[model samples]
Target: MSGFACASSCGLIFKSKESERNVVSLFQYDGLRAVESIRLGAIRCDPKSSISTSAAKCGRIKAMASPTVSAPKREKDPKKRIVITGMGLVSVFGNDIDMFYNKLLEGVSGISPIDRFDASEFSVRFAGQIRNFSSKGYIDGKNDRRLDDCWRYCLVAGKRALEDASLGQEVLETMDRTRIGVLVGSGMGGITAFSNGVEALIQKGYKKITPFFIPYSITNMGSALLAIDTGLMGPNYSISTACATANYCFYAAANHIRRGEADIMVAGGTEAAVIPTGVGGFIACRALSQRNDEPERASRPWDKDRDGFVIGEGSGVLIMESLEHATKRGANIIAEYLGGAVTCDAHHMTDPRSDGLGVSSCIIKSLEDAGVAPEEVNYVNAHATSTLAGDLAEVNAIKKVFKNTSEIKMNGTKSMTGHGLGAAGGLEAIATIKAITTGWLHPTINQHNLEPEVTIDTVPNVKKQHEVNVGISNSFGFGGHNSVVAFAPFKP
Candidate 1:
């Protein structure tokens, strides 16, 4: 016999009809949704029929003596419901999200010739460059000079997100500052600064290195500085997972709110790795496209003639909050953050596992975490970076997880934005969320020759209207990092 272990009454509450020794205890009173709690109970017990006999033996069932008394369940906790309240971005297409996605749907390429530092002599001479970026409201002239471009991007994105969420200084003062957090991240934080510092040290001397080198170059400073500026005393940190950096930050920030560590989180990723060193390093590994003549078509994911990924740089951020918190504040919720997951291939440092085990498992885990069924998802923002092996590997992984399902449609955002390394996932997430709100899926663009192995819909070459109830975004990184995040349209 099994029963509820209450302080007043601890006795067997349930038993199989065939045997007294076969006692099954039902775990009770979960804070999850009704369906999930029901699944955990595993067995049904009617209080009128089963508990009546044991009512005298166990007093806890007296309150549950109704005929409809089934397995234990509880109401869904509002604190666990994570929702997106605001979004902010810095991209080559444009900082305004509507314009950015519109250009993407129109099959416009952000990749162009790199002018940041003369790259005419480099192996690959092109990249996705954001024309002009400024953080006037967030920082002063002196501080901007001291900080790296990556840090400046983080500050601007965070400020824009707060403004979008209406959590400016006047509004933020009303909330509990201790329960707010910042989770912004970067894969190659201040790469330009590091490269400049090294050059200074080599050409001049060790004394020539700037005093701001250590402070601005570290990855954690992005989140730390945001926390300092906003007075968010809660969890603050950064995650560096190469291209998966943004999704990893999103996953961690959502959980921080879900776990009650914070009520609101400013989370996302940023990067500015288009320096000469950045271009040369990838060129050394032969990981960049060499189509200097037709840079626009160089980042052709799944194309037969595609060479490699085009490096891009930008920042993307989202203000995340528990549904209860946002609703209490009357904040305008943009979308819902359903769930997300992360994994490591452990098969190779730079390449994915040939069998595609890691990516496939991560997608399934993300779906399970979101408590969503396979049929509910209609769109996926893939992480194909236009590489020969990478595109097929991701598609093969998708096939394994979502086998024989014609309902799902996917596209590669890298075709337009190029690969932003850490910031790619952030920008792609904004694109996916845009689809949920606008009912449009951006085209994968340059797929003149689609690979035969990809049986699913690639949404090639043209943007189309599709009602998207649920969407998921994928981002894979060097060092075999795999991350997936799920989203749903806000119901209420």
Candidate 2:
């Protein structure tokens, strides 16, 4: 007979009517203890039977008169609700949000030969490299020249996001700056600056290294710079969990608003890791697709011929505000930030767990936190990086949480933008919001041969007109960091 024990110092077991061979016990305790004693096929009692009678047989336990009760389900408070008011990005497609998503819908390939530096010696020679990015009126000439691309991207995106939120310089002067914050993060911050510093230290001396080396090279600098530029004194910080960095930032930023710590936040991620060192590091790990001949088709997520992820660089930022604050200010709402969660695989540094338990748990928690049912999620912006193990592993995890694949449509933004490392989740979140607003789901391009294991309708190779009820963006990173953020149209 199967036996079960209550996780309490006063352990007890009781059999139910459902199964004669199985025992069940339910109790609440302030602290947990290992079940040292288990009664197998002990006293048989109906669930409707008096609790006092069962406790009398179990011994040394005073049973409460109340039946086992579950915790009350949480409901979202409108005042504490957070909404997306603005989205800004610096992508290979362009800085314009609508234009960028339009390019995605068209199945345009941003991947091209790496022309920023001489990549002839490298095994992988292509990326979703941004071409002719200009800060123009955003930053002055002197600072722009010295700033690392990571900081530059962060500053521009953050400022533009504020502008989109109608919180531009003129509006900001009237509001309390203390209630505004920035939480942009990065996976590999200021790669170019760090690489240059190391090169200088080796080739010449420490004297040759620039003064801004340490300040610019850290992961927190993007948030720091944005906060500095905007004079925001609220909960400003950065979280770096590899590719899951942006979603982690989003989760934390939303919580800050919910907790009344801040009224608004500039939150997301930035990456400038397409430099020589960044490329070399991924190449060393054999984590890059080496399709030099057909660079455009390199990032083929869920495709049988996919080799590895292609590297990309960009920044994606969102202006998130408390619904009450946004309503009072007459701000334009794009989408609602329902909720998000973060989990770790606790298995491997570079590889995901084969069973995908951690990822599935993360998705479940995100839905629970969002107060959303599994069936409500009709769209998923997957973290399919085109790696052999990652693609199928994520698919397996997705299948566990979302039982009905027929209702759900999934796509990989990395298919066109490549893996943006820390910035991937933020960029994909923008795409998910666009899908919600436009009633169109962009295609997961380069699906010439679909992987047999991936059963979900991937919107293969062409955009589809699907109204997204609720969307969740998945972003997993090295060191087994898994993150999921949920969003939907703001319904009053």
- Candidate 2 lDDT by residue in tens digits, 1-492: 000000001111112343234432222111111112212233233444332321211111111211333322434676688999999999999899999999898888999999999999999999989999999978889989999999998988888888888988888989999999899998888878888999999999989999999888888999988877778999988988888889999999999989889999899999988878888877765568889999999989889898778889899999999989999999999999998899987865565565667788999999889887787778899988887667777777788777666667899898999888888888999999999998777889999898667878787786766778789999887666889999989986
Query: Would you list the C-alpha lDDT of every candidate in the order shown?
Result: 0.77, 0.80
Clashing residue pairs, backbone N/CA/C < 3 A, model 2: none
Question: How much is the lDDT of residue 36 in candidate 2?
Answer: 28
All candidates: TM-score: 0.84, 0.85
The superposed Cα distance between candidate 1 and the true structure at residue 26, in angstroms, equals: 54
Q: What stretches of model 2 exceed 4 Å from their correct place?
A: 1-75
| lDDT score for candidate 2 against the true structure | 0.80
Q: How close is candidate 2 to the true structure, as a TM-score?
A: 0.85
Model 2 lDDT-worst window of ten: 1-10
User: 260 in model 2: Cα distance from truth in Å?
Assistant: 0.9
**Residue-wise lDDT of candidate 1 within 135-221, one digit each (tens)?**
777888998988888888888878888989999988888879999999988888888778788899999999989998777888889
